[model samples]
Target: MDLKVDPEEMDCNQPVPVEVFASRSTLHGLSHILTYERICIKRCLWILFFMGSLSFLVCVCVDRVQFYFEYPHVTKLDEVSAPVMIFPAITVCNLNSFRFRSVTRNDLYHAGELLALLNRRYEIRDPHLVEESVMETLKFKADFHNFKPRPFNMFEFYDRTGHDIKDMLLACHYRGMECGAENFDVVSHRLSETHNLILASSHAGEP
Candidate 1:
């Protein structure tokens, strides 16, 4: 007996299926989608980070602006019935050499007496030292925050008369003078107020 073989049946042994190709194409599409999603997530995270940094910067700026604008309450010496006497540690800068020295109550009192004498038109034997003392006293008072009035220009007063507070004090020591009441009164009053404030602040920290 002789057997007959078909040519199409031999080709069908290596047949390619449509389902395998479809599954491979589907896997490529899913991979592309996953990559796109990862990029989107990264962009969202970066945006959020930038926004947080911007928000912090804005908050800091606002807080600094508020701090600069706001003024703390300062109690006047006259407001207290009996003002406490406090000798705060003062650093005095010498005008000639620009050297600094620690000032004591004695130094202040001596300067005040000299100021009083100048107010009374009494001649100062050592005008130079007296001038130095007055400048140091003024500088010490100025060190205390808000002791002087706002827009207080020290240079303006200094430029008027050889940068000498002594001359200014001598000229306007008496009442009805060109600059009104004695400059010593202004200095003393401010000094007293500054002293009281210092005392109050020091005692505030006490138990």
Candidate 2:
């Protein structure tokens, strides 16, 4: 068979098969794979992240609901007196380590006892901790201040009290050192004067 081809159609450099066109059109190279695959992978990752974020939000809401329902009686403040008025104002002055602004009497008593223990055992004190512990006790105040509470004005309190709460804590820490507690000084270094005072005053009455 004489298969004579036209000169215009017979470019010797050109590939003869239709597969040449198909191969060129298909994405077979590394560049093609990277460009196409990257977009697909990124889209899948974003979807997964979105799902995880939504699930986390749902979990937080569920926890809040559970807490509110579980402690309905504790949330009630109608019978609870004003923490500022009921608790001795003198104790509220310098303690910053303790959360005290909106606590109940029961909490205050508990904190006071704890403070007394720290003082009696280690000769330590921190007024701020005592005050904070007081606030922790008062249901209404503590719950209200559960978010960001007003910061204690330490300088103002210190000036009014004429007692350096830090000094009191340091004195206790020295006592702890005598008992071979190396960590006591480190704790005292971290806490402010107010905190030290609270530790000192925590357990003054109970034997």
Candidate 3:
């Protein structure tokens, strides 16, 4: 005896149901759980595993959702009465920065051909081609990241151009009470070249 399946019967117009999708899905043992016809030990085990996995995932999602909503803190406002607070030490800095007029002619003279070339470039004139270039020019290297010592005195330049605290702070006060220049000792910032600083002395508590 021989059996044959008809092509017409195999090719149905009806869409494949969700059971087919479940069978092909990545969910481990779900196909087995759904397809199992009877109450066997294997089917019960798959059902238990699937439910436990789903529950754990739902708990994690709930925890993450709670964390997202609770990210910002609550704000509150209140009124209180207290004695006047001390005026903080103020430092004025960098009022006049990199003034071209302050650039001394001495620096331009020391800068030599580099500044000359730039000046020529500004005037739309090409650089003068030197037939006999110096050994230093031939072996020239440029590194912008590392700080190099300036040919000119940076300290003098900063002092001449940087801001003055006496000029900046015309008046000082705490809770409408006036403060004098004696309270602020004018000082240069030790760590930097450009900032003019003022420090409040320990005698700030004195009347």
TM-score of each: 0.20, 0.18, 0.32
| lDDT (10s digit) by residue, model 1, range 161-183 | 12223322333211332432122
- lDDT tens digits, residue span 1-207, model 2: 899988777787666554454345653332332333457766566567666777898999999999888976545456755756421122223344443333333333334345242344222245465565443343343232234434444434334334344433332223323211222222132335443212222222211
Alpha-carbon runs more than 4 Å astray in model 1 = 1-38, 72-207
- Residue ranges of candidate 2 with Cα displaced over 4 Å: 1-38, 72-207
* TM-score of candidate 1 against the unseen true structure: 0.20
TM-score of 3: 0.32
lDDT of 2 at 145: 28
Better of 1 and 2 by TM-score: 1
Q: Could you give candidate 3's per-residue lDDT for residues 1-207 as a string of tens digits?
A: 898978776666556666787798898877888773676887889889999999999999999999899986788989775577354556656644434334444433333234342242222113345333422232232212353445666556556545556556777775467766576664665425356555465645642
Q: Rank the candidates by TM-score, best first.
A: 3, 1, 2
Displacement of residue 59 (Cα, Å) in model 1 is: 0.4
Steric clash count of candidate 2: 33
| Model 3, position 46: C-alpha lDDT score | 87
Please give the CA lDDT of all the candidate structures: 0.39, 0.41, 0.56
Indicate which candidate wins on TM-score: 3
The candidates, ranked best first by lDDT, are 3, 2, 1
User: What does candidate 1 score in Cα RMSD to the true structure?
Assistant: 21.6
